[model samples]
Target: MEASELRRAVEAGRATASELGLDVDDVVVVHDSDRVALHLVPCGVLARVAPLGHLAASEFEVEVARRLADGDAPVAELDPRVESRVHVRDAFAVSLWTYYEPVGSEIASTDYADALLRHHAALRQVDLDAPHFTDRVALALREVNDREHSPELPEPDRRLLSDTLGGLGAAVGTDRADDQLLHGEPHPGNLLNTRRGPLFVDLATCCRGPVEFDLAHAPDDVAQHYRGADHGLLHRCRALNWAMFSAWRWRRVDHMPDRDHWRVEGLNRVRAALDRCGPGRPEAGGAGTPVG
Candidate 1:
């Protein structure tokens, strides 16, 4: 819903705070991409309300936050100073959290690397029999590959994407197991700057799969985020992931041109990463390769 429309809905009784268990005394609307919801409460309560599927991403985010706060993981956990709750109502899911004031600057790549390394270190202590990375790669690949010839897309672009996927297939191979849980979409936007450091916000796409698949999405979205100085396995995986994103973007032109532009740009970036890395060094450019 447009900002105006959502506000109108909230005011017209079409969307009531009580319906979402909100007190309705104070109300605010927040929109991120395709998701839209409200932030409101009574004297001491605060909550965010949005449609069901739109809020699914919150699932993974809350889990990650909880783990981090418990000292089990270290990727900038949410502040313990506030309490949070998630509510699912009919077609909507509302996450009510004590709005926290940022205690630090935005999380940078170095911070992410350190946190991720520690997280993996702790993960090693447990048996994370995650699924084969190939499953996710294949699913992401299909989101773009199957739509290669959608008459609406330019033929040359389609051909280039097809070739790119062909290269990805030969390089990534396949995976069968589905054990490791991953934040399927890990962009800067999903991360929030909070008192604790960088609190990750969306996790609706978290899936049990190989860790490499999660990392690969980074470089693919370089425009949306920067990898900074980290150049290890995760970085390599991120580069290759961009290549896959390129393939996906190249195939997404049929629907809304204005809306799909960013995806297209992302795909182009992945293509650039692939060219730089080449087919041989799956880790060099943004070629899809499973990370361990």
Candidate 2:
């Protein structure tokens, strides 16, 4: 939506903003992604609003606000003096929050690794079913698993689909940690480089699931992309998720060329996981194969 339309919405109270007791000036739209991220400058408060598309989850934004309100220690945000809130702007899915001047980096130089561990640890607070990641996975599997689609799929993608379905079933079945929380889509882009050190943004996909599902993104890979540093964990999970998530993404946007790569990568992830778990696990179909 246009800034003028959004401004009118805010003015009409169709959307909510802080009652800061001040008159506002012009609204500046800051493009973070294709559809969202905007800046609104008033006399006193500067607002940063992000309107997410359907692909992004609203629960993540809600969780961020909740955590901030709860005073979750790790979440460094704008100055406390400048408060923020997450509100739905439209059916298109947008989060309206205030802008905060960066005080430091998103990741602490001395404590980056520890901060990641802690951040992953905190994801346990989200809802698994309400946000419904598992259902999404299941739907993706159903779409590709059908014989009509499988035969037409490239060899790499075919195997990737077969493997992802099998792997998810195995992970859930053996997951002794039944109720693990996850930052469904944690990545470096979601994190902000602020003055306070490694502040997290883009809580649009914060929900509960297997830690592996969240860790699947691999912080090291994101770090490498952003900082050009080596991180084994990040690399491993990046590859793993690349393998698996493609099936899900394909289910949503099947026409994309990247789907081919995702399928191949997924097969590799399956191979790695199977090597670790051994042949004891059953395949997605009735067929059996070597564990290693």
Candidate 3:
């Protein structure tokens, strides 16, 4: 998350867009996280630029967008001006996406839920070569277990992440007969209340998991509206999500905004969720306790 790295990513986006015959002169940095999302002015294209190391993730997302669009799912479309694919330039990976003008700060919970439900229904038809949800947990688990990578992470918190990731991964990993392709994270951040309609973005997080696992990323109001979700499974997934987040916050290489604040908050959330865990799965009839 260095400025220089983002500069390179922006350069990559501009260079690739120029090659594609988009009169890209000025670019605006809309977001800076694992990737630098640049708004290519005049062309109205949102180029999500990241390091070359993220090529696999970007490529997978591009394919997801294309397939979802084919299925008529509510996803942010890839830039159709050029071929729908990831463009690499100057050792960076660039994917051009349709930049929707933000119509509001947020969308209604029901709208968000319905849009995600539509995506889930459409996702059932997609069979991309993506990893399972636990596969991602395994990645975070490695970060927690590697002391050299997270030397400052206290042993107790490390142990918490290790156990939660391992146990919940097993609990949710068993019996995938009903699992479907999920948006990885269908949270509000990924849900854009655009002038066109409700659309979801950031498809790289797509994974094979139960619907509750995807619902866990959403707000409680949203989860309440998502049809037929297993409350018990949602609880486990919420806790596991917090653990994975904690692992990332504690990673030495992660420098996301407000690291200290979120790290503490996420740890507290994990503890509260674990405290709510029962000897057996709670009767699956009621809404899960607010997890965030």
TM-score winner among the candidates? 3
lDDT of 2: 0.48
Residues 79-118, candidate 2: write the lDDT tens digits: 2443344445444343445355555534543454445556
Q: How does model 2 score by TM-score?
A: 0.59
Candidate 2 all-Cα RMSD: 7.4
Runs in model 1 with CA error above 4 Å? 2-24, 41-50, 53-69, 74-86, 103-106, 119-136, 145-151, 163-170, 173-179, 208-212, 217-236, 243-264, 281-292
Best by lDDT: 3
- Give the alpha carbon lDDT tens digit for every residue of 185-216 in model 1: 66665555665665444545555544555555
List per-candidate RMSD values in Å.
7.1, 7.4, 4.3
Candidate 3 stretches greater than 4 Å from native = 280-292
Give the lDDT ranking, best first. Answer: 3, 2, 1
TM-score of candidate 1 to 2 decimals: 0.62
Q: Write the per-residue lDDT of candidate 3 for residues 1-292, one digit (tens) a residue.
A: 5878877888889999998999887999989988888999899999999888999999999999988887868889998889999988998889998888899666888888898889999999987877899899899889989999988877667777778887777888897998888999887788888887898889999999898888888887788888898888888888888888888998888887898788778777877676666665322222222235
